[model samples]
Target: MQLTILRSQLLSGLEKVGRAVNSRSTLPVLAHVFLEACDNRLSFFATDLETGIVMPVSAEVKTPGRTTVPAGPFTEYAKTLPTQAELTLTLKDGKLTVKSGASKASFATGDPGDYPPRPTLAEADHTFTLLPGVLKDLLRQTLPVTATDEARAILTGVQFDAAPAQLTLRAADGFRACVAQAGYESLPLAPFQAVVTARSLREVLRLLDGTHPEAVQIIADQQARVAFLLAEGVIVFAQTLAGEYPDVDQVVPKTATTEAVLSVEAFIRACKQMRVAADKPREALGRLDLQNSGANAVKVTAEGEILTASETTLTGDVTVTGQSMQIALNLAFVLDMLEVIKTSHVRLKANAPNTPVVLTPEGVPGLLYVIMPMVGH
Candidate 1:
């Protein structure tokens, strides 16, 4: 393969597909980036068995061919070159040569035959489209709640449910669950469900930033492979986990014995301050002492093990209803939800001390977050 491309473009394409490169794979080629120079365009491909990514860029192709080279060292070398310099890549006798200005580097090429080929999604199956911003929001909110336990592989992925009128995303890690949905105009196919790994979801988000595609086209085949198509032929594909995702709706509390609305900024600040104290405990759970201070006010007290290193803030506009309560919860989890909530204020609903607390933004529709309370000694 012989090609002349801008250093910046090459770096961008390399970074895009590098997410799927398995640097420690038993097969050496899996850690390398596959380059195909053809049709005045250069394409990069990488896969780690479960997930794969393809990215293409405009280039001046001198000779149309293909080659595979280690991604790590080549990417690092490209980063050190001038961004606007023209980078020339040539393959001869299984050795890849890189030249720009006065600097030159050579890397041993891997056998291109060993690189896994890209999987294609049937065009007929690629009918569903979702707004990039909306999809990005859904992933940001739900991915954090996915379980990391490999034994329950299903919980490690974000579940996508496409109904007749609305599309929903749900995730649960046993301790907490998140459900987010948005209404759609039409259905490309019948209602269906699939689970995509959280890692793949993050990669899709990254690709959306670079491509900023109009809408993400989703395709799920009978073989359980899922693919997201972006602009410029950029695609993120992965194998769906085999199993049923837990019913998250049942875990959300329908009724609340206590409810409070607090300023999102203030609540997050209090949680962070308390988290500093909570970090001392073995369990790493933060303690929240909520009590009705007055009509439209709730005193939030954050205490540590000594209880003397406590901070109290009387949150205003706090419309507390029903009974007052104190709950222990994972501060990190609460902070995660707070970071993603798109609202000036957030509503918290709690039924009992041990039950999960439901959180929802004041104006955001079709988004629900539930966190199971922590047990106190």
Candidate 2:
């Protein structure tokens, strides 16, 4: 393959597909990028079986061909090359050469025959579109709650339910669950659901920088794979996990015994202070005592641990309905959820000490975060 591409574009395309390269793979070809040059474009592809990324960049192709070269060396060498200049890549005698201005380097090319060829994906059984910003928000809320335990394979992925009107994302890891939905206009004719790996979800999130205004098109097949279509011909695909994700809706209480609205900053601050004291204990547990302080005011006290006792309280806002409640929880759980809440205030709903506590970003519709309470301090 002989092509001249802008240095920055080459570097960007290399870095984008590098995530799927597995240096420790049994097959050496898996560690190298498969490059195909055709029609004045250079396409880079890398896959580790579970996830794959393909990026095509505009280039001047003198002789259209294909080659495989070490991903590590190509990315690192491109960074050292002069920026804002064009990079010439040529394949000769099974060696891939790189040149820019007066500098040049050659890398031993791997046999392209060993690398898995990009499959010809069929017409999607279902498809939908989502703005980058909205999809970004949904991932942030749900990805964290996905179970890391491979035993419950389904929980390790973010479940996408493409209903008639909305696309909902749900994740749960026994202790916590995140359920969020984003609206999409004119969704696919048939409702479909699929669970994409967390690793792929993270890559999609990385791709959606705030600047890009393109709505990401989500394409899904019957069961094997799902691909995220970005601007241009860029596509990110992943193999879906087999099995059914748990239904967390039953644990989500329809009624709350006590509800409190507090400043996000204030609650987060109190949690941080409680963090230091909670970490002193073996299990690092903290307690939240929600009590009615006065008219339109409720006091939230964060109490921590066996090693060093710590407590802080603040009172504020709305009506504190029903009975007072005290919830024992791990401080890190709340802190993680609070950091992602993009709002001035947060609403908390709790039914009982043993039940789940739901925290919703105030004024943000269609988002729910539920954390199961801990047993003992």
Candidate 3:
């Protein structure tokens, strides 16, 4: 492979595809990025078996060929080069040469033919189009709830279900659920529904964000991989988890026995204060007391006396006994949820002391958050 490209362009392309390069893998080839120079453009490709990415950059292709180089070292070296310098890549024998300005480097090359084939979906059987911004917004809202555990493979992926004129993305990690919906002009022909890994989806979104594609083409086949063609410069491949996502709709309660409307900022601050106390305990324990005393206000108290060195007093009257619980939840999770909620006033509801607590915006209809109550001592 021979090509001459601006250093900035080359580095950007490498960084874009680097998201899929496996940092630690048994297969050496998975750690390399495939560089292909053809038709006046150089394309960089990387895959970690489960996820793959391709990014193309403008270059002067003197000879059309392909070579695979270690993705990590190559990216690191390119990033250090001068931005305005011209990068010249050449492949001879089993080695690849990278030259720019006064710096020069050589690396071993692997056969491009051995790289894993990019999966393809039937163009006729499955297809859908979405505005990039809208799709990104939906992912940002829902992807956080996806499980990271490999044992619950289905829960690790985002569930995309389309019907009629609506498309919904749903994700859950047993304890919490998030769902986002958008409208489509027409129903997708094949009803392309699948559970795609959240990690893969997040990587794809990152690539898309870098490119700013106007629209994204999604293609999925039954029992096969899914492909997202963002533009001429980018493509993403992800394997679908082959299991049914749990019935999330059923898990969300339809009625509430106790509901309170309070400021999101206030609730977040109270949670943060409680977290300071919760984190100091060997067995983290924090309590939230909610009571509706009047028409316009509901009381909220977060207390953890076990971890505090001194007694803390509230300036206001107490309306309910401290609803104490010995739950060890990562405080970061609570903070993440608070940041994503899109309203100032949040309505919280709970059916029973042991039941899950649901949070929604005061006037918004679609967004909902359900957090399971901790088993109290």
Give me the candidate number with maximum lDDT.
1
* Candidate 2 vs 3: which has more lDDT: 2
Residues 74-125 of candidate 2: C-alpha lDDT, one tens digit per residue:
8998999877988898999999999889999999998888898775468678
Q: What's the ranking of the predictions by lDDT, best on top? A: 1, 2, 3
Instruction: Give the Cα error of residue 33 in candidate 2, in Å.
Output: 1.0
lDDT of 1: 0.85
Looking at model 2, which ten-residue stretch has the lowest summed lDDT? Answer: 298-307
- lDDT winner, 1 or 2: 1
Off by over 4 Å in 1: 123-126, 280-284, 292-296, 305-308
TM-score of each: 0.94, 0.93, 0.88
Candidate 2 similarity to native, TM-score? 0.93
Clashing pairs in 2: none
Tens digits of per-residue lDDT for model 3, 50-118:
888888889999999998899999888888888789989899998989998789999998999988875
Pairwise TM-score winner, candidates 1 and 3: 1
Candidate 1 backbone collisions, by pair: none
lDDT of each: 0.85, 0.82, 0.74
